[model samples]
Target: MTQSGEVTTLKGESTDQIFNLKREASIYYSDSLSTFNDIKSAFIKSAGNSSLQMVFLLKGKLNGYLTGSKKACLTFAEQQHNILLINEKLQLQIKTETHEAIFIRIDPAFLSMYIPADHLGYLNLKDGMQKNEPALFSGCNLHMTSEIAAILNALRTSEHTGFCGKLFLESKILELLVLQLSQFELRKDDPAVRQLKEEELDKMHEVKEFLMNNMNQQFSLRSLAHMVGTNEFNLKRDFKLAFGTTVFGYLTDYKMTLAKRMLIEKDVTIAEVSEKTGYKYATHFSSAFKKYFGYLPNKIKSGKLSLLILIEDFSVVFENFVTMIP
Candidate 1:
């Protein structure tokens, strides 16, 4: 491993390496990472500039805690992704396993260039760490679709090195940023999705915690609302307003997330997965899984399809981007 200033470099095999930080007119980033050993935790002070970061966790586990937080604010298990807007220093605690991850940092101005100027005014792309407000466009520990994972793998394992490799990697990074921006553009503005009153939000959160804890069980809206000391109408509306989706939508997504993790990380059977995810019928589970991920659970279990396929497949939907590529 090598170290200089705030950067601590580690060496691995051909597939396991770290590229030095690259900078241009509007972007700055360290090369991709695939580490084979665990190292001590360290601190990374932000550059003060408002830079949005897209982080891909290809393999292993990474735990990141804020300076004064009691617990980790960011945890990247294998095959997860995160988009971070950094405005303060951070402490990283590496787990005792090999880790593979990549980070791409974008200057806000650079990002603005791609976004329509009028739409850009309404976008929340600022660092909210100092003001104690939520950072605009901040999404931490997000799920990694199969397609994105493939792109990350291509970037990580590509034989291209030096200038050509750098150029290729930069192009891939731009592609990813475009994908993310397109996603944001498609999101319906929740004019009605404003923040709920503190008490209502707290109650809604309680309902969410209860649902997560009892994921293997089923409940109606009325029952869930009663459990959390709210009515069904308010529960349904406020939960969606606070969490950006319906109650069951979030639950199903959460269940499938766990199902994917269990299927990949363990040797559990399909029926076992169905039972664990609260489906009495394995067929029901399979159908829901296919609907949510656009692939079968059997494919995921058989190693025929992976989470990366989602990004790969979705990118083809953008005809302009597809035409731009050779």
Candidate 2:
């Protein structure tokens, strides 16, 4: 990999490292640690035309807008992926804070080399990029999966150098692209799925934020739909299309995940964790936890299960959880 040394900026002590995997593909890893209390912004320039850019925010919050379109500012949070098609010169206004992110840029022609024309129909993103069309997920925030997260961590922490490193990075990038594109493929043949408008997508995200912030509060489908200015039917349909989960399903997963984290990290009792996670009764919470993780919450607190074992168990249990959802 062709690597560049880190460069510091004036707004704060930030380091940006660029890795040119090949002539047509590159990766930009950025770490920004702002010193001032006030929010700062910066303009970023894109190098290639008609390139597909994927932004993965691993930590902190980032807000930006295209150079000419200040009205449509975008906010990206941790573990969110935003894919965009850059047909012209693109500039980003970044907020200065303690943040870490990875930006991958791929030339359409280079990406097309790997995807056979006959199979292109299955990959909507490839076809769109080839035509210089707007990205299908331009304003949407796709949740990062565990598999994608593992690849990203490898890409960031790989120790191989020289040609071996270049090969490793390129292969990982293609693997990442395949995983991301496969998500879109899942809905390609589903007639129930429809393209969500920007407003509707924003509403879906708003509902997600509301759930994450108010985890202790119980919400019905009707209440959440009304809270986001949509009806239950559309909310149920569009939310599933947008986030790949039913409304309450996402809530249950979120609560269970939070409960697990609390059990492992916080020195709190099962009852406290249960109350904090919106459970009416500790017994009910323990039952749900056991069902979700294949073990009771006390096991986590008692040090019977290690973190690695918990992660592996959660993966298996989550697969069962998702499959049992519908």
TM-score for predicted model 1 compared with the true structure: 0.53
Model 1, span 1-326: residue lDDT tens = 22211233212221211244334212221222322121111112333433456666555666766768869776665545556654444445555534555665554555554555445322544425335332435342334443354455455444554555555555566666655554444343424434356588678768877887887776899998888888999998887655556888877767887787677657888899999888999999999998987778888778754435434444544554554343
TM-score of each: 0.53, 0.53
Q: What is the Cα-based lDDT of residue 280 in candidate 1? A: 92
Provide the lDDT at 30 for model 1.
26
lDDT of 2 by residue, 1-326 (tens): 11221332211133222254333455556665432111122212344345566778776666655556766455665656766654443344446556666666655555556555555332556655566554434334665554565666556545545555555556666666665555645655456656677688778878878987887776788998999899999899888766667777777777786787667656899999999988889999999989976778887888765535435534653454354333
RMSD of each: 9.9, 8.8
* Residues forming the 10-long window of minimal summed lDDT in candidate 1: 35-44
Model 2's number of clashes is: 0
lDDT of 2 at 12: 17
lDDT for model 2 comes to 0.61
Which residue ranges in model 2 land beyond 4 Å of their true spot?
Answer: 1-54, 57-182, 310-326
